[model samples]
Every structure is written in structure tokens, then in C-alpha cells.
Target chain A: MGSITLRAVSKTFGSTTVLRDINLVIQEGEFVVVVGPSGCGKSTLLRIVAGLERATSGHTLLDDRPIDNMPPYHRNIGMVFQNYALYPHMTVYDNLAFGMSAHKVPKKEIQTRIGQVAELLELQTLLRAKPSTLSGGQRQRVAVGRALVRQPHAFLMDEPLSNLDALLRERMRVELRRLHERLRIPTLYVTHDQTEAMTLADKLAVMRAGEVLQVGTPKTVYQQPATVFVAKFLGSPPMNLVRVESRTRGAMNPVGGAEEAVAMPAWIQEGWEDATDENGTIWCGFRPESVMKRRGPGGLEIPITVEAVETLGPRCHVHGSWGGQPITLTAEDGAMWTRGAVMRVAVPWDQVHWFHGRTERRIEPRPARLETLETGGAG
Target chain B: MSNRLSRLVPATAETPVRSAKPSHPEKHWRLPTDWREMLIGYGLILPSFWVFLVFYYGPAFFLFYIAFFHWNIFASQSQFVGLHNFAILFHQPVFWLSLFNTAYYVVLVVPVTTLLALALALLLRESAGLRGGGVTRALVFLPHVTPVVATSIIWVWIFNPNFGLANALLRVLHLPALNWLASTHWALPSVMIYTVWHSVGLYTVLFLAGLATIPRHVLEAAQMDGARGWLAFRRILWPLMGPITFFVVILVSINTMQTFSQIYTLTGGPHGGAGGPAFATTTDSLLIYQTAFLYLHFSLASAMSVVLFGLILALTLVQKLIADRFVFYR
Candidate 1:
């Protein structure tokens, strides 16, 4: 019943367009994380839904009813701000009961609801303590409790865990996920931390420069990013994108070095023969994990000069240059590689993603293969 | 290895070659050697301290001393009169009337000025985001910076019963023209109105500063909680402003009690002495000034001064206690 739909929502402050043509739907019990860099208008989009901001264009709906002109209170949406925004003057119980009293709920009902929420949030011991007396995590729990006690239609969290320390932030993320699972309310959470977005979101929307670049399940977005930005933004070490130009009909060379040119894997040539741009060039992207240590038969291989290695307990990152392009690969057995060692690294052909060099959009694998390329395979 | 270890250890077997003990390493509570530094620090403040001692504390002590003697400024010799000034003040109708007038003025001015200033501050705070807010603030604050005597004279002219702006407005409204400063019933109120006009600006600025210290997100959170307009003010803003309200009340109380310049200018000339038209505007300050300067009753004036000082101190203490009970400090 708490479904929220935003259609072509745009916001312009003076002449600068902060949010442009944002369209998203959050279903009941769905957790959508809007992940973006700072100033990406993610917060503005959330505010528009919460009615704290008015969209320059388009409509926002709550449960099939238009709420564009509705005030925040009338819309019955609970929001958790970045700083927690707890009333410093009020105790934890008062903070939790504030919203219900504002809505003129009955005294007995408010008491029962506060008791229930406090018990659920483990805030029974802190009911009489003011916000200043609570620690960061405890204050954050009280803020969430305040929103929960309201029993609003939906929740909008604006980087609710950003102020917490790293360890507490991790713990709170799990608690937030558990809370959402228990409550089953449609939630739109905004954050710049990719790990939080990937882990917490049922659906992830990657935003950049005031535009939603891609929205999909975390697995889909991680495995098949629609654009180079999404691929670069989502991963920790990020995707390694190397510019490659077709040398002949079937051979391609990583840019800046001709000695590294090799025959394009037969599967790729067969899969995207017609998908190459007019210049026969494309930007190739692959995850660090896709860079295999051992060369597989029929796979594309590149010799990498290892520069440095970072050992992270069980796994490590091998940093090096492949065909003069900087690349990092996660290696499970990184102890075998040493500085300045030249090793043959193979690229699994199926895991490689190709983008048109000019448009920067993913190129679909086509079934067609050029007959001239088969004839000119000798080159 | 045992022989080497024995050599490395300075054996206590050598009968402990003891060094001479230093003489008296500790002295009990020696004076600070940096006495020159202390002298310089005290030297820096000595001038102001001397002024305070001679002018403030000295006069306060003298006021107490001379209150017990029948003294006049022009008298060659003063007579010792124990409790005589107090006895005369107790029986003096004019002194009682002056005390009542002062209380009346304080009761009228403190609340009116504080509330007016707070209201103005709220209005100005709402417009603070607008372009003309600074100019409006400066305009309101202009009267505060103006000389009190000058503004009070202007107020006297405005309160003139004949051909005055106030009576002119009343006449335009078809109401009978009433005497303002000249009428006994209206004289104290007229002075109070002038005092509020002169002083509301400063307190408004104070309240504005207080309002600014309230975080924006807290108020926004209140609005999100469905508290708007008067509800927001009553529940959130008022409680948050408790400390500033207390401060303004104390300041206005002290300022109103010491109000002599305005009453002197408004009613001193051609009205009736300093008390004016049958002692209507005679506050403690004005009465003290009249008793000493006009009537040459120095001992009685000193007694009144001591009483006023005690009253101010007691009232201030009371206000502080009340403030401590209610004001929430973050």
C-alpha cells in the first residue's frame, strides 16, 4: 500500500539543474538505494518525494494518489536525516512520541506505541535520557525509533549512517536491513558509499551528474553495467577499461602499444563482429577478478609487468601495467608474484564487456560475423 | 660468564660509596620567584581597579555611611541622626508615591518592552533571508543609538497636548484630545511608551541573535512534526528562547529601574519638579536626583540610593533564581 512512483521529476535551482528527469518506482516492501557521488541530486530527489522540495516538473505519487502538492505532514512519510536530527531538549521517549502527539493520536495509544517501539529498538533503558546523553549509535536508534513509532507510509533515509564510525556504521547497516525486513515498508535510502548501496538495496540506482545512469539488481548491475561510469563507480578497485582498436579484420591491439596486438578471440569476433564502431575501436572493460593468473586455451592473453602487490589477508591485489594500461587484478595466491616480474595474464573472453568508443554505451553481442574478416584472418 | 656478570654488576659489597646529600631540597611554601611578573599583571589592571574602588565601591560605602547622618551639601557641619532619614522616608508620602510610581513604571515597561522586542525580533527574523532585512534592522536599531535625552525631548514634543502629533491623530480619529505628559494619569504611561520606543530596538537585536543560535534543522524537524505557526512558537521556539528571554527581562528591569534621563526630560520642565504634576512620574532614580540636587537633602537621598541598590540586587537575585528554574542550557 505504500508504493511510491516518481515520473520525470526534475529540479532546477536558479539556472542549475540539480535533478533532471528522474523516474523511479519503489514498491511496497522494496528497498531501493540511490547511490551516487556527492552533489548528484540524490538527496534532492528524496526531498521531492518527501515534499520538502517541489519538483520543477513531473509528478510524484503515493499509493496511486498524487502527492505533489501535499505537505510533508499530510503525506505521512517518515524521514531520517543525515545527522539524526534528534531534539536535544527532549528525552528519548518524548522524541519517539512527538510525531504521534502532533498527529493528535490518543494518549493511551501513544504510550503503547512508544513502549512497543522502544522495546523493539532496545531503547527501554534510554527513554528518560536526552539525545546529548546518548552515543551516536544510540541516538541513531532513537531517530529510527521516532520514525518507526509514527507508522508512516514510507521511509526516506538521507545517509542515515554517514555520521557513525566505521565499525558502528557497518553494524547499523545490518540493523537497518533487519529493521526493514521486519517492518516491510517501502524505503528509499540515499548514500554515496557503494558498499552500503550494494549490500542494502533490493534495487540499486547508480546516479551521476544529476542523472540516474542505471537501475537494476546489484548482481545484474555488477555483472553487466550499462555504462563505463556505472562499472567504474560500483566496484571497490573499479573496472579496468582499456581502449582497444581493431588492427585488421580479427586482430585488436590495446591502445598506445603495437607490440601487444593479438588476434581477437574467436568467440568475440564471432559475437560482436558488426558491433564495432566505424573506426573499428571499442573500450573494453573487465572486473579485476576476471583477470585470470593462468592462461586458458583459446583465451586472450596479455603480459603484465607487476609493479606492486597489496596483501589483504586471504586475498591480495596485484597492481601492474598491461600493454601500458594500468590494471589491478585480485589474486587469491598473490604470494607467487613479486615486483617487476612479468607474468602472462589471461582474460576470460565471456566476461569481457565492450562499449562503443564515442557513445560510451555497452555494445550488445551480435550473431553476425563478417565474411571478409574470416578471409582476412591471416592478418 | 659468571666472572663477567659479577664484574658488570656494581657490587654492593664495595660498602656503597655514597654521594653527599643536597642541602634542604624542599622548602615549605616558598614565595613565588616571579613576583615581578605578578606585579606587572596587577599593574596592568591597577588603573581600572583604582577607578572602580574610588568611584563605585567608595561611593557605595559613603552612601551607607552618610545615610545615618542628617547631611546637606551646603551645610558647614552635619548632625548625627540615627535612623532619622529612614523614619522621615517611612512617613514621607512623596517618597512612598515615588516608590509606587517606580514600581508602576517597571511593571508597565518590562513586559511590554520584552514582548514587543521579541515580536519585532520574530518579524525581523522571518525577513532575515530577504534583501532588505539589514536595512530594516538598522532602522529599528537607530533609536537605540540615538541620545536618550534627545529622543526624550522629541517625545515630549510629540506628547505636547496642543498641536502635537499624538493628539492630532486622536483628533483625526474624532476622539477628544487628552493631555499626555501634562496629565497626572497619563504622565507615567507616556514616559513608559517613550522608554519602550527607545529600548525595544536593543532587546530586539538581542533576541535576533538568540534566534539565530537555534539550529535550522531543529526547526525544520519541528515543522516536519506538524508543529507550525503559533503551535511551533509556543511549543518549540518559546521554550528554546527561555535563556534569552530571561536575560532580556533582567536587562530591561535593570535599565527601567535606572531610568532618570527620559523622565527628567519628559516632565522636568514646566510640569512640576522632577516628580512632575503631583509626583506622578517620580521614580526612585528621579526622586533621588530631586532630593539631592533640587531639595539639598543629601542624607535622605543617600538612604533612597541604598534602598534602590538593595531593591535592584534583590530583584536581580530573584530573576536569576527564576531563570535557573526554567532556562535550559544546552
Candidate 2:
């Protein structure tokens, strides 16, 4: 019954617009993660949905009822803040019981609910301790317990796990996922960490500069990013994007001084053939993992001089220059290469992403050519 | 063969032996390590420490010693009269009356001033950066910095029964004019009003500082938890401000107890005999001054001083004990 729909939501602070035309929907039991760089308005979006902030335009509906005009408390949404925000003066038991007491739940029912939540969150033994006495992870569990005890229609979390150490963050991530599955409340979690977005989200919304660049399943966004921004933002060391000028119809020359020409894959050329620009320029993007050492190449081969190598146990990132543009390629540890060594790297034609130079919008490859490219390449 | 013979000799026997008596090296007299630095540190604070000891503690100890004796400024010698001054003070109705008046003044001033300051702080905190905020704060704080004697003189004029601003305003509202500082019934109240106006601004600034320390996210979280406005203040803001409230209570209590300048300026000087109109406004401090300087009962005044000091100390300790039960340090 907890479904949230946002329509044409925008927020402006004075003259500066913090969010624009934000349209999204979360089905019952869905977990949506909104992610962006710092100051991309992800936190503001959560606040607006929580009714802590007012949107300049548009409506937010929870369970098919308009809640934009409602106060934060009346909106029936629970929020876990980035800092936990537990009342320092109150014991953990009281912290969890505060909202229930304020809403005038029966005293007997409050006790029962608190007992159940404490058992569920494994916080029974620490119920009398103040928040100052609890460990960071323990405090986090208490914060989640506080939110869960209310049994709100939905939950809004603003970087709840960002305060933990890396190992604890990973463990909490799994626990949160399990908690979501068990409770099935529609939750909107916001974080700057892409790993959290990818792992915890049933649907991921990537935002940049006050607008959602793309929203899709993590797998879809990862494999087929809709924009150069999304492609560059979602991956570690990021995807390698090269600027090129389209020469004639099927070939492209690097925009810089390098004299190398790369033949556009038949599928990419076919996708853009009908909508060819007069200047014939485009931006090409591919993930670091997609580029491999040339192995009896039929795919496009680009020669690169290695500038640096970062060995990360099982895999190493090879930082080098390709056609005067800096590119990073992730290779297995067995692909050992030293600095200043020239190596030929092959990009699977099907894996290459094409975007218009000016607008940076994805151009869908022709279906038949894409199928051939996928089958012809080794998986 | 020679090398083998040399190796066969015992090592200890070949070594040189010292005399049975051990020699003691000359002990040089030197300061301990870091002594110079400690000296320098003490040297830096010695002036202020000396002033406090000489001016404050010196008089306090003298007063305590003289309270047990019949001491007079004109007499050549003081006679030791153990507990005689205290015994006389206990039997006097004027002493009890002054003590009660002082307690009344404290009761009126502390809570009213603290609450008013907290309310003003809450209202002004949100508008701190707006157009009129700085000007308003400065105006409110002006009386605190102004000379008490000067402001009390202005208040005397304002409290004038005939043409003063207070009476004029009352007349505009169609109320009868009444005596302020001149009447026995209104004297203490008039002094309390002036003291509150002069002291509230300082507490207001203190409360504002305390309010700023409360993290914004905590309040937002409270609002999200279905606690708004008064509920949020009661549950979150008030509890979080416990330490500051305790501090403000102690400070205002002490300040009100020791108030002298306003009383002196408002009720006329010692020639007019401090607590005028049948001692209606006589607080402990004013009574102590009038008894010793005006009536030449120095020993009795010293005894009253000791009692007043004890009362202030007991009150502060009791407040601290109570605060420990409720105020959250963190």
C-alpha cells in the first residue's frame, strides 16, 4: 500500500534552482536509491519527499493521496538522518517510543511495539543506554529501529551508512537490504557513493546539476548508460570518454593532434548514419573493464603508451594515453605491463557507447547490427 | 706455548681492585628540571592572584573574624564577644525583615529575568541576519553596559509620580497614578523592575549562544518524528538546553543576591538612609551597609554579612545538586 509518485517536482532556493522537473515513482516494497556528486540536490529531494522542504512546483503523492501540502509529521513518513539525530538526553527505549507517545498510541500498545522492535533490531539489552554510550553501528541500528517502530507508509534515508567505516558500511548495507525485504516499505535512500546505489537499489536514479540524468535498474544503467555523465559517474576510475570527429560516414579521427584514425563499428555508424551532423563529431565512451589486451583482434584496436599501472590485487588499472586522450583500462593481474610500454587495446564494438557531442544523449544502435556485434564478440 | 700459558691465567685476579670505601662526588646545587619554566608560569599569573587574595579574601576573612567580636571604628580596641553579634542579630525584627525583602527580591528577579531573556533570545535568534535584528539586539543590550547609577537616575525621573513617562502612560490608559520609589509598598518592586531590565540582555545573549549549539538536524528530525512547535521545544529543545539553563540559573541567582548599585541609586544615598520609607526596600546588602556605616554597628553588620554569604553558598550548592539530577552535560 506504500507507493510514492512524484510529478514535475522542482525546488528553487532564491534564484538558484536545486532540483528541476524531478519525476519518479516507487512501487510498494520497492527500494529506490538516488545518487549524485555532492550538491546535486539528492538530499533536498529526500527532504521535499519527507515534507521537510516545499517544492516550488508539482505534487507528491503517497498511496494515491496528495501530500504536498501536509506537514512533515502528518505525512506519515519516517526518516533516518545522516547523523542519526537521536535525542542525546533520552535512553534508546525512549528514543524509539517518542514518536508513538507523541502520536498518542495506547500505552500498552506502545510497550508491546517497543518490545517487538527491540527484539527485531537486537536492541533489548541496550535499551536503557543513552545514544552517547552506544557504538556508531549500534547507534545506526537504533536509528533504524526508531524509524521502524513507527510503521510509517514509507522511509527516507539520507546517507545513513556514510558515517560508518568501510567494512561496517558493507555489512550494514547487506543488513539494510535484508531489513527492506522483510518490512517491504517503499524506501528512498540517498547517497553519494555509487557502490551503495548499485548494490542497495532496486531502481537507481543518477542525478547531476539539479536534474535526473537517467533512472533504471542498476544493470541497465551500468551496461547501457543514457548519457556521458551517467557513464562517467557510475564506475570506479570512470569510463574512458574520447572526443572524435566523424570522417566521412564510417571512420572517426581523434580530435587532438594524434594522427590515429579509428573505424567506427558498423553498428555505431549504422545507428548514427541517418542522423549524421554536418560537422560529423561525437563523444565515445566505454568502461575500463570493457577494454582488453588485443587478442587476435577483429574489434577496433587502439595503440596506447602506458603512463602508470595501479595493481589492485586481482585486477590492475592501466593508466595510459590513447589518441592524445587520457584513458584508463582495467586488466587482469596476469596482463603485466610496465610504464612506457606501448600496448594495443581492443574495445568490443558492441560495448562502445555513442553520444552526440553537444547534447551527450545516447544513440541507440541498429538492432540487427547490435545483435551481430554481440554474437561475434567473446563473452 | 706462551699464548696458551697467557690464556690459562684467571681473569679476575689480573683485574685492578678499588679501595673498600666508595667516594662520593661533590653534590652541586641546581634547580630541578623545568623549575625555571614553572617559575615563569607562576610569575605570569602571580599579579592577578595577589590582587584576588589581598582585596577579596583579605576582607572576607577580616569580616569573618570581626563578626565574633564587638568591633567599632572609633573604639581604640575591639573586645572579643563570642557569638554576641549573631545573638543580637537573631532577636532583631529589622534583620528578619531585611532578609525576607532580599529573598523576595531574588524570587522576583531570577525567574522573571531568565524566562524573559530566553523568550527574547528565541524570538531574535531566527531574525539574526535580517534587517532590524542587529539594531534590536544592540538596543536591548544597551542598559546592561550603561552605568547603573546613571540609568537609575533616569529611572528615578521616569518613576516620578506627576509627569513621569510611567505615570503618563498609565494616565493615557485612564488608570490612576501611584507612587513608585517613594511608596513603601512599591519601592522593592520598582527596584526589581529596574534590575530585570538592566540584567536580562546579558542572559538573552547567553541563551542565544546556547540555542545556536543545538544542531539543526536534531530539530528537523524531531519535526519528522511528529513533534512540532511546543512539543518539539518541550521534548528536544528544552532537554538539550539543560546545561545552559542550569548555568543561567546559578548566574542570575548570584547576580540578584549581590545587587547593590541599583538599590543605592534608586532609593537615594546613605544620607537618605539606603532602605527608605521604614526600611521597606532594605535587602541584606543594603541593611549590612546601613547598619555598619550609618548606625556604627560594624560587628552586627559583619555577622549579617557572614549569614548572607552562607545563604548564597547554600543556595548555589542546593541548585547544583538539583541540576545534577536533570541537566544533561553532553
Whose lDDT is greatest here?
Answer: 2
Chain B TM-score by candidate, in order shown: 0.86, 0.88
Model 1: lDDT of residue B52: 100
Model 1: residues with Cα > 4 Å off, grouped in runs: A243-259, A262-282, A297-300, A356-359, A367-379, B1-43, B50-61, B68-83, B172-175, B269-272
Name model 2 segments beyond 4 Å from true. A246-249, A257-259, A266-281, A295-298, A335-338, A366-379, B1-33, B74-76, B126-131, B171-176
Query: Model 2: per-residue lDDT, tens digit, A51-71?
Result: 989999989999889899999
Lowest summed-lDDT stretch of 10 residues in model 1 chain B? B12-21
Note the chain A TM-score of all models in turn. Answer: 0.93, 0.92
Q: Write the per-residue lDDT of candidate 2 for residues B91-179, one digit (tens) a residue.
A: 99999999999999999899999999999998898788789999999887888999998999999899999888988988999998879
When candidate 1 is compared with the true two-chain complex, its DockQ is 0.37
DockQ of the candidate models in sequence: 0.37, 0.57
Clashing pairs in 1: none
Docking tier of model 1: it is: acceptable
lDDT of 1 by residue, A9-101 (tens): 999998999989988999999999999999999999998988888999999999989999998768878888888888777888888888788
